[model samples]
Target: MNAIAFTDVSRSYGNVLAVDGLNLTVETGRTVALLGPNGAGKSTSINMLLGLIRPSGGRIELFGRPPEQAVARGEVGAMLQDGELIPELTVRELVDFVRGLYPEPLDLDAILQMADLTDLAGRRAGKLSGGQSQRVRFALAVAGAPRLLVLDEPTAAMDVESRQRFWAAMRDYAAGGRTVLFATHYLEEADENSDRVIVVARGRVVADGTAAQIKAKAGGHAVRFTLDGQSAAGLDALPGVSAVEVTGGTATLRTADPDATVAALYRGTSLEIRDLRLAGADLEDAFLALTREP
Candidate 1:
């Protein structure tokens, strides 16, 4: 059974639609990454799942129950962006305070060590840096050792080292039959860490699949060639070519029909093709293509 499921969910404020009809599912024990630009309804979608706000339409279920039911049962761990932690309490104290709310919670010391906060145990949560504050929230999120973990922009403010540590800790935690749902705009993080990625744009799911699958769907085939005397106008007339971007001596032709484009290009130009290469599709390339205007 899916850990989280949304079917035709939509949220609107006045005349502005934040989340359009959307369907998504996160299986138990898989880390599903949600990718989108700013104000793309990522937060609104998450808010519905977290029970912070009611959806304007459609239905959502978590662990086969409604959002409030799942949350009321203490089966969820969520760390939304900018959620405040007590400013005066030390890291240790904050973790302890959050831990006291759960019946069978994880050990505070273990969580601290896993989060690499042992060194900063004495540091006040309020005085900590942005990265440090995020870490504190992460510690609290896992303190209950819940079944489902939800994180929004978890490593946005983290440094290289801290981001690596956080990913490792997250992997360890999710390995224990726990599901993870993360929303972020970081392409590398989504590509490298997520088991699956659901991309949202304009309040709708633009793409959904594994990193490679989604990239492939976004059309990764690029034909790189150099034309001796063929002008930019001639290149744009090529059959099956979607776009022609030229710089220096190279022209990168992005096309869905690579064979047709290559045939047309050869017919149009006599320039010796030097270093003609096909660039494989990558997540970043795919994301840009998907989010780009059609």
Candidate 2:
């Protein structure tokens, strides 16, 4: 069974639509990324999945049941952007507090270790730094041994070393046939960690595919050249060049065919090429191109 599914889901706040026509399917044992800029409804979608908000239209299913039902079964875990952690509670105390809510919970030590909070177990939540607070939230999320982990900017805390450790823990969790839905502003994290990538813009899904497939959807490769003292002509005007940007005698061409673009760039100009190289397309490129302001 799919871990979670949303069919044409939409959420509105009065006259404002936060999420619109969102359709998603996430399977067990895989990590799915929900990526978008601010006001893209990434948080709203996650809130709906967590049973914290209601969709205004369409349907949502979690583990063959509604979100609320799945949540009631205590199989869902969440670490939201804003949490209400008790100030006086230490990491150990907070873990114990969340653990008590579940009938069967994972070991406290294991959770703390996985979240790199073992050393901070005695530190109070209010005293912990931003990164440290995030780790404590992660510890609580995993305390119940959830079958579905929903983390929003889960690794916004933690140094590089701790982030990798946390990622390994997530990989192990998914390998055990659990599901994870991750939302973050960190593009590199989504590109590196997810099995599938979902891009949301204006509260709608504009792209959904693997890392390579999504890049391919944007277009083929391009050729970029830096000119010395003349304007770049013919290259930007090529038939296959989809988009072009020129500044300070430097031009970047987004082309549908790389070879054609390269051949055309040097066909008519002796612009004193300082550097000429093929730019490989990737998620960041696609995102910037697709979401360009009209």
Candidate 3:
């Protein structure tokens, strides 16, 4: 069964539409990333999925049941962007308390180890660092050993080391055949961690595919080289070159066909090319291209 399904789902607040006819599905065991700019309705969609709010129209289902039913049965778990840990509680106390809420919870020790909180189990929630708190939140989210794990900016406020450790733990969790759906602004995380990426803009899905596919959808590779005082004239006429930018003796050619563009750059031009490099569009590039204002 699919882990999640949003069928023509939409949500609105007075005159503002947060999610507009959003339609998508996630298969079980897939690690999917939901990406979008601010005001793109990512949070709203998450809220609706968690039964925190009702959609204005359409339907949502988790494992062939309503979101609320799935959540009530402990089939879903989520770590939202905003939620506070009880300051008086220690890491162990907090995690243990949450795990107790579920019928068949993961072992307390396992939760701590998965979230890298074993070392801080005795630390008070208020005494922990920002990254530590985020870890604690993650531990609570997974305490139920849920079938679907939803995280919104799960690594926010975390340092580089913290981010690394978090992703490792997240991967470990997902390795168990659990479904993961995260919304993050960190494009590289989506590129490296997720099996699929769904980009939403203006309350709608603008792009959906693997990282490479989405990058290709943005349409082109970049061919860069130093001009070495050579004139950039007539470079745009080269095969497959769609856009050309020259700055400080460096030329960047955007082309749909990198092979032809590179060949033309080297053979067709008499200009001395230095530091030539060819690269495909990255996730960030694709994101920008996909989410640009209409």
Tens digits of per-residue lDDT for model 2, 1-294 = 899999999999999999989998998778998877778899999999988999999899999899999888888999998886899888899898898788778888888888888889999888988878887888888889889999987887678977887788788767777899999766667777898888888888888888556555566466777765676656567756887878777777887567666765667455666688776664466667656665
For model 3, which pairs clash?
none
Worst 10 residues of 2 by lDDT: 211-220
Q: Report lDDT per candidate.
A: 0.85, 0.81, 0.90
Give the higher-TM-score candidate: 1 or 3: 3
> Model 3 compared with the native: what TM-score?
0.89
RMSD of 2: 4.2
| 1-294: candidate 3 lDDT, tens digit per residue | 899999999999999999999999999999999988778899999999999999999999999999999999999989999988999999999999999999899999999999998999999999998889999999999999999999998988899998999999999999999999999866678878899999898789998999666666665578999886788899999987889998988899987667787898889988888899988765556667788776
> Best lDDT goes to which candidate?
3
Candidate 3 residue-wise lDDT at 102: 94
Worst 10 residues of 1 by lDDT: 278-287
List ranges where model 3 is wrong by over 4 Å.
219-222, 230-240, 255-274, 277-288, 292-294
* Arranged by lDDT, best first: 3, 1, 2
Query: How well does each candidate superpose onto the true structure, as a TM-score?
Result: 0.81, 0.80, 0.89
Candidate 1 at 94: error in angstroms? 0.4
